[model samples]
Target: MGWLAAGADHEVRLDAGRVVARNRQGRVLRSVPKAVRETEAYLELRQLHEWLVRHETACREQVEQWLVRSLPVPTALIVEVWADEAWRAPLRDLVVMPVDDAGRWDTDRAGLLRDADVDKGLGVVDLDGETGRLTSTQIVLPHPVRLPDLTDLREFATDLGVKQGTRQLFREVWTRPDDADARRRELTRYAAAHYRELRHLQARATAAGYRVQGGTATVKIWEDGVPVVASVWIGEGDPAWETETGPLGFTDPAGGPVRPDDVGPVAWSEGMRMAAALHAGRVIAEDEESA
Candidate 1:
């Protein structure tokens, strides 16, 4: 972006989401002069940087939502957003597979996204280390949990030396166990985690993108196209007081308890993921440390 004049001697422009200033001699300044900072050009650049930061975050979150939902994304949409760096960054190198009209994935057509061209097609690098363009109009970026031979894909990704902007290939996954009793306890495996303070736990949950309600840290997932809410009981009362987390559980849209068997693969994985993230922040007490 061209530098905008700040008064007569100073000029300012955005540099990697920051407002930077330069002298009239065209020498870059180490710091934005205090006087120039108050100029309209500096303030506008600062405001633009803030909006860009928010746009980047929103773009990444939207891509994550697509991965979690396994939604079919049209190439046209990709083409439209490809020019925007905020959207391009998160969508880069993600595994994508062509989807049939009936919403079925063609595993053989799976590849790592590289480029999107409106006139040509979606460009990708397949599993065998071949680069090509997928002419399919719509494609699904399958979640790691749904991919076949996930171990092979991980090894392949490692070989390609490609880093995915969105968490997919290397993301942790969990599957519902076959035994009924095991399924029942699947959601509760991370229970009894300890935190020094309720506020700390609440803050952790919020930072992890989970909602902290009155007495629970919750995450809602759309499994099988139905809303499934998973919650972990974080004791209520004074936020600064010490607290312990309770068992994780899931409920339907109506707030009715969802049966363990009824919880689908995606819901089970996501519910466990939420609990595990919170549990990771748990503090081991003195006595427990000795034990």
Candidate 2:
């Protein structure tokens, strides 16, 4: 048998009654007998695997945070990180925008990164659905925060045959319908069992940048300098077990009810996103009986 996988910059192989590690030059670095469960070589290999897993997770988490917050990332910073294989793996094939010297996203210069070239700069598929090279000194990784813009970007990327390895956080969000009266009615009676406990849901909502109050989750957005607040009732339940959620409610800064039609698109989308997320954690009827 030959090496089946590569890990921590070394080739790993299961040999005759042992595990073997080899360097890039095919030189045997270490071997661990199958009977030995805690040899130095085995421990080192385990540590390497653990480190690699943590590195991968850290890279993805950092990138995801940037996307969720719609933060502007410098092109130079990305290019610098691309030099490392661990960081590059998560960033490959993501949509990136070139930033002009003025520190603004130049949509005209945006493209899907095919490769990060140290010498020639980035190889990309531009908005025109054509392959091109972007040699700009600075670029911005725009978060897919704008729903309409994200849709157009996906369509453009599709035309160029660009496929991303990681999830696009700023993708378009789906809502049930635009009918205010119908949506209000649905929300009034909405109740779903969450897979997570009430406390867990509340904590998650708070960590996601929402306000947690009296066992309810609230998100506030400003429209034209007026505060638009949306809140969902998260019922109290055992902290360690799944719980059910209560109805969702929306109100203005004055504590007055705001109709769905009166809510701006941004606020509406964010409010629904919170509701849908909590709803997704619902404990199914079939699972309840099993438990």
Candidate 3:
């Protein structure tokens, strides 16, 4: 914003989301003068900064929602929002795959998002650090569990010093064991986590962006055109009372149990991720003795 006369001696303008002042001699001050801070220009800039902060947060949450659901976003939609800093910030450097007309993931062609141009398509940097563009009509930011060569990808990301605005490559994932009794083992794996209070467990789930209803912390995943819900029961009794978390389980849209062996990889990993997050905190109640 252009500098505006603040007082007889000072002129102020919005600079890099901050209201900065310059003396009459045209030297930038280290900080806004005490008197200038109360000026209308400074107040306006502060309000703008607050709005931008909210905008950035909202954009990031939307992008995270897309990643969790593994949605195939339209390329045009990406291009439309690519210009906005709030939207671009969360999208930049996220590993993306082009989706063919038949909706199959071009797994062999994954790249870190870098730019979007209407005529040139989405520009990206691939695993080999080669700059390229994918002209596919749609693309997906796959969940880590769905990604191939994840170990190598993490190494490559680290080598490049890449830091994603949203968790993707670095997101923790769980691989459901494949065995004769995998179902039972998976069910018991993260179960019976003792919490000092039922409310504490519930609070953790909610704070981690999962929905808690009917004593369960829940997240839904859409895999292979089917919806699966994963939930961990925290308990329904008195909120203040101590409790133990129940087994993490998955169910179909119709509410039928989905055995761990039958659960899709993305769903299994995300479910376990949510379960682990809620199970992480444990405290011994004063009434109980340590093992």
Candidate 4:
């Protein structure tokens, strides 16, 4: 009863009346199928992935439990730490994955373990459905992982910046068609405004001699192709902004500028600016009494 955990270039094959699996590195892993259903090959791969995740979870939970009992700290302190984690940690990172299913391991099922602050690691696992003989290989132990305590100001600040930046950028760059509902239309307009502003800022900054990195530019258009400035990206040395530059036909090695196809809803402030400019040309009638 052997099993294999393999990857993209590797697969389990029924060879010589036995299951033999190879990884991308040409290494063979020992594995046995827990269940085999005749289905599309893709579905089979998915099933194996599911099994791998389950085994990895079981093993990681066991490790955490062992840590609680084995640590030399007082039981009260351990309990407090556990309670704190239970309440605060979103526990999202606890979900398992297959980082390098290609690596050969002597186990029935295998995957990867990833946590917020630690490097992802390989997991080797085994399972027995009938008598519940679930086991794991205790080889290549992973580095210790610690989840961020939300109260940590530094981590909180970093998270805040990422969320705010992503939300603002996404809304500004991608827009919806007129057939979209009011909610969708509003979102497109918001994104358009953001794009236009970013472009304007990038141009101004670059012209002033600051290097703008990963910038985007956007313009709004009517369904019939009338152009208006919708939004723009303005910053120095931010690589993540690269994705939002698509509104321009091509991203500038130095920056991006919006074109007619990028149009969406205009911000009220933008409209007001146009009105102000228009009024600037008008002459006011003089009051006879004051004259």
Q: Highest lDDT among the candidates is held by which one?
A: 1
Worst 10 residues of 3 by lDDT: 282-291
lDDT of 4: 0.31
lDDT of 2 by residue, 100-177 (tens): 677666777667777777777887876666888777777655545443367777777666665565567334453445
- Model 2's lDDT to the true fold? 0.66
Best by TM-score: 1
- Give the higher-lDDT candidate: 3 or 4: 3
Q: Local error of candidate 2 at 4, Å? A: 15
**Cα lDDT of model 3 by residue, 185-260, tens digit:** 7776777789878888988999998999988889988886689999998898899898888888999978899877
State the lDDT of candidate 4 residue by residue for 9-113, as single tens digits.
555654444455665676665753333223244345556666655665564454433321221222222223333333113221221212233433322232122
Ranking by TM-score: 1, 3, 2, 4
Task: State the local distance difference test value for candidate 1.
Answer: 0.88
User: Model 2: how large is the Cα RMSD against the reference?
Assistant: 7.7
lDDT of 1 by residue, 1-291 (tens): 999999989989888768888998999999999999999988888888888899999999999988888878887898899999899999999999888889888999888999999888899988888999988879987777888968888888999897999999998899889999988776678889988799999999999999988799888887646789988998889988888888889898778999888888887888889989888899977897799
Q: After superposition, how far is residue 65 of candidate 1 from its true place, in Å?
A: 0.6
State, as a TM-score between 0 and 1, how close model 3 is to the true structure: 0.82
Q: Which candidate, 3 or 4, has the higher TM-score?
A: 3
TM-score of each: 0.95, 0.61, 0.82, 0.17
Error of 3 at 249 (Å): 1.2
